[model samples]
Target: MRYLPLSPTEREDMLTRMGLAEIDDLFADAADKLLKAPLDLPRHKSELEVERALGALAAKNLAAGAVPFFLGAGAYKHHVPASVDHLIQRSEFLTSYTPYQPEISQGTLQVLFEFQTQVARLTGMDVANASMYDGSTAAAEAVLMAHRVTRRRNALLSGGLHPHYAETARTLSEMANDDIRILPPDPLAQEDLIAQLDDSLSCVVVQSPDVYGHLRDLRPLADACRAKGVLLVAVVTEILSLGLIESPGAQGADIVVAEGQSIGNGLNFGGPYLGLFATREKYVRQMPGRLCGQTLDSQGRRGFVLTLSTREQHIRREKATSNICTNSGLCALAFSIHLSLLGEKGLRELALVNHANAVALAEAIETIPGVKLLNQSFFNEFCVELPGPAAEFVERAAARNLLAGVPASRLSPRAGLDNLLLVASSELNTDADRATLVAALREEAAR
Candidate 1:
């Protein structure tokens, strides 16, 4: 049966008592933004009708694998091993909730403990949390953490940082009344982050193989940030790049946050992804999210427990390090399981394969007339300057059954980057995919 908490009379009486004439009066502040009419969706339908309608809508989408896919700006399409899915589905691993009681929740705690260890080792940081909502939120939390640690109110974001990530940090900072300066888009990776650092800045967030797929050397920026007493928050949208490039921590980053989706996670239509957050040992107190620690029982049996949970739910609202109540536990487990399956050597080899594929694709793209390769160095993704608007090229490619890459204009419409396209090549992509993309681009450019 349908449940109604209040009748029309009760709601009207409450509104009247509050000096509101109607329900809409309560939203007076946002009256301008209120919708004038209900949505165009069907009001109601039978179960079978709803299912058929949804199925029809779903069929309209072209499956990623059905075409020569190359789309990646933040979320990527990588091959997740079948075992990773098989193991994460086990009843114990699948049904576990928050580890409120370590004795009863040892299994969950241990998984988080191992996950933390793996993230720390992967990012070359002294420590890591269980996980965050996603990379964008993790980046925002890093900014907040920097504010707490440095007692500064300003953050400088690199132009190469993903627009979504920068906007996430900006939104949080606005609420905290902190200052966030976002540089203009740097498709060429020409922004000198060091020159923008100042004493008022709490941190400088930079991304390697940034949104434009141009790799950045964080060491110089890290050194400059240190000299200025500012923290270096490095964002990694493509975590696999760490396998081949220097880790943010090793490059002197004070905090490293990444989108762990590329590892052991599918695109899943852009979500339920993992966020990897890591930082130096000295700054553990200021770190956000859950931290798991290893310990021993009375009988000296090794165990794991929640070492730190600073969200408001666990502590006083004012004292909480973050308001993020939970971690991506299941996704973290999948990441750990996949990483375990692919030891160090395996990950490095996988990264090499991605790079090789990207190199070949880039070479093929450069051969196309009027198509210009943008990056001098990249891991698995790069941008190309097309002869026409990138959006148009993408549309043309789509008509030909080629899933072209993301366009810069789609990310930042007013940035005058309409001619630039961001293409990502992964292990899932093949020589056939590369040839298809090249042929599509060649045909479109010739037009």
Candidate 2:
């Protein structure tokens, strides 16, 4: 009765008032498979019994830290400093909501401003927003922004772009009656993406250290996009890679978007991750999400405020540049805090360690009988072709207490890459972890 506040008669009356025969009728628009599906959960259970049942189900998952983790495609397994977790859990940050009142929300506003500055500096762009929902949505918003800026209806997507991001952009583009031309997956960075550019293209999306872990040369692509009057939207799933690689903006990208999960955030079984979005100063007016700006209050005191007025809430719906009402404020705070702790030099050093570990892992696996390395230029992650089905190898490795890499087939089933496995190495991965991965792969190959 505590959970179900309404009586059966009251529920019936509400349904009648809404002109619905039953509660199920409210889901008329949902597909039959979803609307008619049953959860198969028990109707009632004691608190202790419920906890035990949930714990049993949770135990079935492979904990990232409990095993030798090598899994990475989009989400990575980087070590977060203990201080980050402790600081983020503080009530001031964890309980804060959107900073609607500039005067009273100075702490939240300043944090977001610092986050935007850090993102802009990291991306080598002129400006950056507060943050976005995540990398995938930021990518989709980038496409929409391009459409508005270029006044074009077509986009060109690189083959190596993360499938999830590509799909998100395509879904939004399709809804707007635009064309999304996605190239096939490129295990090798050999695609001539420049040739695909044309005047009708609104934007060209490309990912560096792509899903398969191959770094791309964005300069040539950026040149071609410029020649065709197309916006070059560069996507980076690993923000730390920027410390080692050239910033996408420096390579002529008009806009740069990245996932900020690698620095301060953990895998957390996927999200809530932060999205970093930045662009050239000339195009800042068209950028999606919110932008935090540094200003002086009436008393000549320093203050922070939302700079651009383009989100749906602040403007007419039809005239709004983006509908992103809120941002990942807490995650952005975590990101800024971590980056502040690890300044420019520290970030570079951390990146170097990650690259060294990955190189060591690659070398260790290359000696194995049936595994072959596929990336010539990668930051901390690379793709390997296993002698057997990668999915089977992954399962076998898991049996050996090694949380191995993600199989390419699992992410892109139609790509015909059953033997390709994506492996990543972070600073957290130790010599023992690499050895464990090597031994597991060797054992699987021998079998």
Candidate 3:
């Protein structure tokens, strides 16, 4: 018999307390629309039959290892050391949760503290928190934090920001009823946004090596924001680019939010990615999430401790900077270990490889007919203006057993961007993968 911790009587009593007749009442509207019939699923089979069925189904998946994937926008495919996965899977880290109860979570807390340090160093910021859900959420959270810091609710988001990241921020701001001004996506939106800045605006968020993979010159933008007393938010989805380019903090970015996945974390089907958020030391208290600090025990043994507990959900219901709970422990740990393994020199070298691979791919793809490389300046990813609808072209390529790039229309429907395609390449993509994508594009062009 299947085991349920809640007995039927107890469940009924709990529902009674809530003044609900049955659990279906929780989904009353859904219940009203319930399929008047059972789902037409396949018939159940014996355990052995099920195992055989699943094995055959699993055989159909074209895994990253089996294919030369050139897919990346936020998440990327990079070389992860065997040791990184080995250490994260260990029972000790997997079993742990929030390090609030430090006595029992020292190992977990120390690792988080180290991870924070890694993020701060990589982003060139004064401090960083344990971690956030992923780059997208982190980018969203950073917007709210900016609003609080400036005591202004209006935010100006550049069109060049990652479409997913921008859309997420807009949604979160809507829920918060925060006024956000979204700019048009300009692959070459080099206009100084600071000129439009004013006392009413809370912050200006811009991404370098933006969604199109173009490297932005943020120093001027940062300077413009400073003139208006506006906060400059720098968002980086491609963290590896930092190793190869100038750090945003070195410019005038008051807050630097980036996805930490490209460094040590793997793209596990969109996520479980790490968010890297950092800023000047003065803003540490106002920063979101838990922060780990170095402290000394009675005997002066160096130890890590939770620095600020003002976060909502941490204290009485009324007081909290945020309601976010439980950091991405395993993902952050993987990120920390990988960065540790690839220290400064190694990270820069790996970045060089990624950029080189991308450069090589771009050079080769440009040679194909009916294909125009749109962005003159980009890193790992760039837009390709195809001769036909990008979605159809991508599907055609997939039919040839090749997974083409993402269609622009997918980001924003009929964006009149149907012909634009965003493709990416990392160190893992071989020369053969480039040839395949180009060949498929040529065939589609002919058709």
Candidate 4:
């Protein structure tokens, strides 16, 4: 179906009005290699044909749910309950937006309120926002929040932090002109990060069950930050790991941000993921995104409303804390539903299952020749130093129907880490899957 919003003449007229002759004019500076001579392929298909063709293509791909997928770095593969989807699709939530209309948006507001509460409790903080786009953005926002709270601009990102989250932080920092210090990505290189702490530092960002799945003792680091009057920003891409490991907040994090994808959200390709952010009550005022609060209506009945909206619609352009409008509503809703289903006991059990699966996998893989398990401590995901290129090894594993995780080379090709492979095993993996990966590694090494 041609869903083009503008007609040919409409587009031409608009372009003329804007003093542009053609769309190609906008691409004049584009790389010559990128300026392909349009598609020299098949003709456009009708809607029905398009659907059938896409379905055929999709059928050729392996479904992670159907296999024991051990591919996690940021996003995770977990069993999402059917009820979460059903509840999220209810007419009240499906049609709502903004939640500014208190009378009509009560249900949405209440759901968001509960979501915020669960996030705060889960992260062990005083309060949490309704949500952010995902973990990376939340990490970047946390850096900004720290800058605001400390009136300082320097941010020290731990070497163990997720590369994607670190990159996102750098992107925002470059724009904010915030001084950024990044520790080198070293899976086993433990350094005196605290010694770097000073008055110029706004916050120190670190991850637990870090990018390589190695867990770092955050106590000393947190203590140093606190003593230096620097805020500790903890980023957790694997929120489920929190149930099994120490809470980042309890470890002395002033601001805790995490990816809520592992729990209530499915790994739909890459996203739409919910970002969970939490912090002390004093820092709430500097928090980005919206916040839901409970109040009373005219009849003294319970109600919910969007109390703190830092985006442009709610505040002066210059005074707003974040221009990140439109909180991650649907993803947040999915997370809320999932978290509600997990309760306290359920989450802990699930976390235990994940850890057990990972441990089982590590033990099996350690026996494989030329495949060195790089992490001695981890929760679910860990890095392995392979005899060959990690990307090549992952491809070989994929050919054998195993979704071996991200490769270190994919993170940095020139970083001289070609032999490094990042692997993950989640609750979805079975004993057979662990055996399969180990056997495959042994066979590949023999070749």
Candidate 5:
């Protein structure tokens, strides 16, 4: 019943063998606060008692589905079919890891292959990897891949790119001594990114239905990047937008990265979400994450194998395309399953419903006093400028049992955007829910 088999004498022996006096010596490099602070948790509890304690804590927070929820920035709330959950829980998928040997792991390998194909087709790219950690990490990886392909170290981040994604790319680029230029947030999608392009820039990242929900016209920026021999990295936080709009790849994006959570995954307080990464065939070797490729066995039987796995485990640390350890296998499976269920026609119809719902909500908000719409063209999400600080309005709404949208200041606290709120609508949203949000905002503004 002893988790730590070593007794006091055995532990002392090991420490002595390592020329250390105690186990704390092993954590000498850790921060003083980390080594000193004890967790504020009960020292002991029975299984049922622990469950009851945790349940009490959980009940203190409001569930998303219980309120008229309208939150969306990178994460969204879409109805996932019960069948998708049931299928992913199948023992073959729920517990599978990356198949080391493809011969015996055909089921998992094929699932990955299908996932890759689905992503590639959806993104209008020639190739796609299994998946990335999430949309932000994928954006960071795409920037690195551009650097590798172009032999340049400078990246340009659109003002509309999600702050988290921009921060992720900036941190990684800074570590490599690469230059990353980020424009100020442009809620109207009017930034002249083409004029900002230069020969030194390795890639240009633009997000459509950007953080503010203003759909960006990436064609001109893509042309500019191509003219300057710079790669164009297009980011999509709401992957469902692809169903309604022209694929970014079709508009000249060299690399496309997206958060596939909108398709099948739920916002489990942010993650675990699927990161969809795809690119043109010419840059496949430079792409990060594992790639699943279809092949034939000796018997001419169809098979799936890892075509490329440029990670620290498979290649020299310095030569690996990405230091990323693994992919979001289970999340990817869920995404694939959801998209499969919604064939091309079903996806388009779903997208149309999302757009219509958002438009109706925007119209309702616009009619209210002291509120202004910021997007002229958007898919399912948009921004609204309020009379007072968004944080204050959100708190007031929550008190009335309505979960309002994210405040722009929450993402960029110092950007002087406290009056801005980012809101989204999906198929899950109903007319009544939209009405509740508008009435709450109107009352908050009047106060």
Candidate 6:
């Protein structure tokens, strides 16, 4: 039998004390659209039956590694060192909770401190937090932080920003009743973001090697925002690009937020990914999540501790910089381990391989009839315009045992980008995989 924590009378008494009429009343502030009927799912099932049903459903998924996969919009397919998995699974790393009491959590705290240093150095920023839930949420938190810093409520998001990231920021900003302006989708990275800036704007959000896979020059936008007293927030969906290209911090981004999944983590069928956030030292207090720092103990021994935790749980709700309760600890540990394995030189070399592979893929696709490469510059991903709907071409490619790429419409359904597709390549993609992808595209074009 299922255990019920509270009896009817106790629940009614608690509700009455809280001035709520019923359990449903507790969710009264939620929007009517969000308050949907309960899902039509089985209330009970035997363990064996449930396992069989789930296995059957899981069998339908096309594993990324099983085919000639090129799919990447945000999440990417990378070669994670077997050692990374082995190291993170150790009892101390896997079983540890938040480093609440630093005395007993030295190992976890030191790892986080190192992770912060790596992210700050990688992004060319003054400091970095331990981690955030993921890239999108880090971005939303960045906007909120900007609002707090500039004492302004308006934010301008470039068209090239990932649609999901934009939506995430929008949802958070709506609650605070802030103004967020997102430009039209620009696959070619041709939007004039400077023209949209004004004194009322708090920040401008732009993605490098943006959603369409075009590498953007944030310098001009950065200069513009600086002139307007606006914070320039740089978003990196593909963190691998940082090794080969100029770091966002060097390019004058007042704030840099990135999805660190490409490094030490796999796509994992979408999540348990890592978020990297960093900024100048002056804005450390305004940063979300936690900051791990080094200190000297009673005997003068070096120790790590939670230097700053501005979340609601650590302080008064009104005084907290963010409501985010915890960091993505295990995922962050995996990322730290992977980066440790790949020293600075190693990361750059790996990045070069990814770029070389993507360049080869782009060259192959250019040879296909009626297909056009959309990016003049990119790191390891780019957009291509096909003769027909991109979604239909993707389906056809899948039937031919090749996972081509992400169709633009899948991410921005209402943007009229049906003919565009986002393709990515990494060290794991071999000549055979590229050839297979090319052959499939050639077949589609011939039709």
lDDT (tens digit, per residue) of candidate 4 on 1-447: 297789888989988998988977767777475656777788778989989999999999888876657788898988889998898888888877878788988788888899988988888889999898999999999999899999999999988888888889999899888889888887774756888888789999998888888898888988989888899998888999888888887888899999999887888888888888999998888888888988899999989888856444457477788877777898888888887888888889999998888888888888887788988899888998878887887887888778777888787666787878888887778888888778877876777
lDDT of 2 by residue, 1-447 (tens): 446799999999999999999888887777475535568875777778879998999899879999889988889877777999899899877887777789988989988888888999999999999999899999989988899899897888998999889989889889888899989988987899888888999999999989999999899889889998999999999999999999998999999999998888888777999888999999888888888888999999999988776555568486788777888888888889899999999999999999999999998988998778998989999999888899988887788788899999988888899999999999989899999888888877787
Q: How far is 154's C-alpha from truth in model 2 (Å)?
A: 0.8
Model 1 lDDT tens row, 1-447 = 025589888999999899989899888999999888988986667778879998999899998988889999999888889999998999988997888788888988888888888999999999999999999999999999999999998999999999999999999999989999999999999988888788999999999989999999999888999999999999999999989998889999999999999999988888898999999999998899888889998899999888756444568477898877888989999999889888899899999999999999998888887999999999999999998899988997898888899999999989999999999999989789888888888887888
For model 3, how does the per-residue alpha-carbon lDDT over 106-145 read when each residue is reduced to its tens digit?
8988898888888888888889998888888888888898
Query: Candidate 1: where are CA atoms >4 Å away?
Result: 1-54, 310-312
All candidates in order of lDDT, best leading = 1, 6, 5, 2, 4, 3
Best model per TM-score? 5
lDDT on C-alpha atoms for all candidate structures? 0.91, 0.88, 0.83, 0.85, 0.90, 0.91
TM-score of 6: 0.88
**Per-candidate RMSD, Å:** 6.8, 5.8, 5.7, 6.3, 5.0, 6.5
Model 1 local distance difference test score: 0.91
> Which model, 3 or 4, shows the larger TM-score?
4
The TM-score obtained by model 2 is 0.88
Clashing pairs in 6: none
The digit string of per-residue lDDT tens for model 6 on 350-395 reads 9999999999999999999888899999889999998889999999
Task: Give TM-scores for every candidate, taking all chains together and pairing residue i with residue i.
Answer: 0.88, 0.88, 0.87, 0.88, 0.90, 0.88
lDDT of 3 at 432: 88
Which residue segments of model 4 deviate by more than 4 Å? 1-47, 310-313
- Structure candidate 5, residue pairs in collision: none
Report how far off residue 358 is in candidate 2 (Å). 0.4
| Poorly placed runs, candidate 2 (over 4 Å) | 1-57
Better of 3 and 5 by TM-score: 5
Q: Candidate 4 overall Cα lDDT vs. reference? A: 0.85
**Residue 181 accuracy (lDDT) in model 3:** 85
